[model samples]
Target: MARKPDTDKRIAVLGLGRFGGSLALELMRQRWEVIGVDANPAVVQGYADQLTHAAVANTTEETALRQLGITDLTHAVVGIGTDLEAGILTTSLLADLGVANIWAKAVSRQHARILERVGAHNVVLPEHEMGERVAHLVTGHILNFIEFEDDYALVKTRAPAEATDRTLADSELRTRYGVTVVSIKRPGENFTYATAGTTLYAGDILIVAGRTRDVEAFASLG
Candidate 1:
């Protein structure tokens, strides 16, 4: 959905890493006034002509960031990935400056835990998570899934061996596995529902829900 252009919403992105650069460009494409900052001279120069204002500055320096008026921005992202210390320092400074929303990137598990403890609103480890997803796909029998919270997950897994050739009511999946069959997708345009009196086929994909471990175990059933 296209957003109605709002010229007044100020957004700032610190660190011109690949992720930050893409985010700034996207915000600009949506007609938002964006301020992109980075300490790298080459990165600032490369995007100088692309953004509303691009500058080379130390984002972790509270004084420098305050002078940029980043506090006035509605949202900001601290996309420092290479240096864990810099990422944490920049995030801490942004929180101290009272930025309304702050999103940060983490390179490791410990790094993510620290960012959360330091008052960052959101933490992301995109590369690490993507690597896991890709590995799952490559190994096969791992249906598509997404983690919504630490414990719960929404997954689309292949029908378990016990569920094959069984109708929804006969499967007893909800009572046994504690997973709700949200939907079922068959070949072509066919789809079965939780209420559908349909028998499962060999290649059918079942969109299920439960704890993460439950989902993993079900996916392992060839």
Candidate 2:
């Protein structure tokens, strides 16, 4: 996984709205130096004591950003949610300033595309992604679902009662369920990579990976 600079792992958050404010506070809690910037003075003051440095500045303007040492930070998040134009401008400025890791949040597909095109290293649609995850959780079929590109996912779920107490080879999951167990997580124990000899016990949790449909089918066994 990519990380911030080893010598000075400081991250700058542009925009002090709900998303950016929460991100900055979380970063601070994780012991990371954070510079919180916002065009609104009131918002900057709100987090002044909690953040390493909270300043009221217009990130959309290159001059204001340069004065705020925006380029000095190697990591940044452009969560200017309400203003697409400002979000795009901030992303562009951050890229031009050579910020290595730029994460931008967008409200819509079109907004996300624009941010990406303007040099956002990563674009996020939080609401949409959270909603999808919630939908999966509500099904109560899988313990957890991690979506990847397309409809593929990596899930952790309990072993079905009928399929317990048997070696992985005996379960015939690949043949019968069309899914593979990547690992097994026993209660209060670290996960162990799945092998043909591994046996599933009642309540054993399986870390599985495959298409979403295949994962669901596999989970249905439990």
Candidate 3:
């Protein structure tokens, strides 16, 4: 589905690292007016023509952020990947500026907790999230996986022959593996939510969700 345009949102992305740069561009592509910032002049210059606005400033400093009018932004992203202290400082400053939403990237659990305590509305651990998905893929059973929150995941796995010709209730999934079969995707068709009576078939893909451990166990079965 095409996402609704975010034309009304004035966004600021501090940190022009790989993730931050890409995120700012994507938001602009979705029609959001974005200010891309980075302490490195080279990075800022590279995106100058591509973004609505791009600047080189020390996002950790209050004065620099104020000068750029970042405090007036409705949303901001502190994507400092290597500088943890700067990331924390930027997040706190954004909160002080009363930005409605502040998102930051954290390298570790401790960093994530600090970001939250410092007033970040959301903290992301991209490495951990992507690593989990890649690990599942290497297992060769999981077709796709997404982590909505820590310790839980939504996974798509191929339906084995034995699992076919049976209703979801007969699968004993929740009772045995603690996963709920949420939907089924037949090849070349849209997703269909799985009901208790929904029959599974070979070659059908199942979307299941639950504790990560349980999801892993269930995927291992196929």
Candidate 4:
């Protein structure tokens, strides 16, 4: 009997390399049913016990994907590394299969463009993004950074000296610096939402949101 697809919180990950394997494990940790697929039998075997289902198949072939019931899966991630042809073929096949959400890994700008053109709903350049994030962390006081479209970013960093000992309204961070401290965490206590009347203390960790340049300038303040 053909297994009925469980759309809710179920995902298929193709290519069980470092990126795909890590993603599949994390999804499992989050309580998602993950179907892991890899062309290499050894890779599939290693993850068989960890995932909901692990299979050895060439995802680039439509017949192979059909045999694994990939068409029934609403979400799929093509984590194929280095193999541009396989990645593109798999993404194209998934799109033709009518998978609603297709996320693919790209090795370069051209690869990303082609993936988008071929029908990858989302393309991630993990190495590029990680390198950019590391650059921000090492060059500034930013403890963590998440960049969004249009140069906007949310960052975690220590409260600047000017912001310490003053309420959020008094500091005029939004007006003067064009950045808003959304939340703060003191040394021992948990993070709390930042309000106009909330006073910041020295060494408090702040989660700030603003344009990239504005956030950088705010983090640079003494």
Candidate 5:
């Protein structure tokens, strides 16, 4: 895993809308030093004293951002839900100022593509990703799965009918399922693959890791 900086964890959030406000609150709750910015004075005042620093400024202007001293920060999140042009400009300014990580929330796929093009490290589509995960689980037997990275995932699925009544070694599931059998959760036991030689009774949930499509296909086999 890429380690975040060991120095002071400083985060700057632009736009004091609900998404930005909530993120600021959560970061403050974790004891992170946060600087929050918004174009509306009232919105900035709403989070006064809750965040490390709150200011009213238009982030689209490079001069205003420089004056706000936000360029010194190492991390920033652009949470503007509307006026994507402002978000893209602010993201570009942050990147120019050498912010190591910039997380920009996009309202649509086109917006996300533009943000990424503007040097944003990550473009977050919270609703889209959540919907995809929910739809996947609703349509398949996967209890839960987490996307670890672009090409990797961790998934937990109910043992398939064919997977029941067989030992892990007997199943050759790695070859068959094309997923690494990380572990198994029997009704009351957690078994690692090293010890998967034991019997797998029905209803045992198998925790596996692989590509998203592979994991989903294996999960649907139940």
Candidate 6:
């Protein structure tokens, strides 16, 4: 008898390139059963021992995917690089196979749009996102930053001089700076949720959220 698929934690990653390979390994570290698929026999052989299952198969073909039991998996990632046609076809095939969750990588805005139209549940432009993130980190005091689709951003940074030595309510951060401190971490202490009455001190770290420009301005304050 065939073992039933664990839809909750099992995933199929099609393409063993850098981004896909890294994501697969990390998912494995988190205890997910990962099936790595690629057309290159050498690539499959390289990851055969590391992944839960690795196979060399042309992912763009529906028959090939079915032969590999990809239809049984609930989640799939189309990580084909550069070959836009192949990536699109593979994503479409996964969608047709009734995979519940589909993630695909896009190299450009047009590619992202096409992937979405072709039934990709999620599309990521890794290089563009990484470039934006790196630009923020290098240009500001932010230790980390994540920007959303709506131009809002969440960032981690040290408490600015104006924000420290005062309660959040008294500081009037939202009124003055247009940003909200979501949480704070004092030296040697774990992070705690921030409240209006929460007081900030120098050297404390803060998790803040606001419009991207507002957050950047607030972090720039000395």
Best by TM-score: 6
What does candidate 5's lDDT look like per residue over 71-153, in tens digits? 77778999998888899999887877777888999989999999999878988887887887788778768888788668778
What TM-score against the true fold does each predicted structure earn? 0.81, 0.90, 0.90, 0.94, 0.84, 0.95
Instruction: List candidate 3 segments past 4 Å from native.
Output: 1-8
Worst window of 10 by summed lDDT in candidate 2: 1-10
Q: Model 6, 1-222: lDDT tens per residue?
A: 132343588899999999999999999999999999998899889999999999998898989999988888888999997689999999988888888889999999999999999989899999999999999899769899999978999999999997789999999999998999999999999999999999999999999999999999998874
- Order of the predicted models by TM-score, top scorer first: 6, 4, 3, 2, 5, 1
C-alpha positional error of residue 171 in candidate 3 after TM-score superposition, expressed in Å: 2.7
For model 4, the stretches where C-alpha displacement exceeds 4 angstroms are 1-7
Model 1 lDDT, residue 24, Cα: 93
Off by over 4 Å in 1: 1-10, 26-33, 190-199
Give candidate 3's TM-score.
Answer: 0.90
lDDT of 2 by residue, 141-202 (tens): 78888888898898888899877889989988888877889999898999999998899998
Q: Whole-model lDDT, candidate 2? A: 0.87
lDDT of 4 by residue, 67-161 (tens): 99888888899999878999999999898888888999998989999999999989999999999899989976989999997999999999988
List of clashing residue pairs for candidate 5: none
| Model 4, residue pairs in steric clash | none
1-222 per-residue lDDT for model 1 (tens digits): 122232356788898889999989998999888899999999999999999999999988988988898866757888889988888999887777777777898888899999978757889898998887777667577768777677777777787778888887798776777677788888775656756477777888877778877776767775
**Model 3 residue 188 distance off true place after TM-score fit, in angstroms:** 2.7
**Deviation in Å, model 6, residue 127 alpha carbon:** 0.8
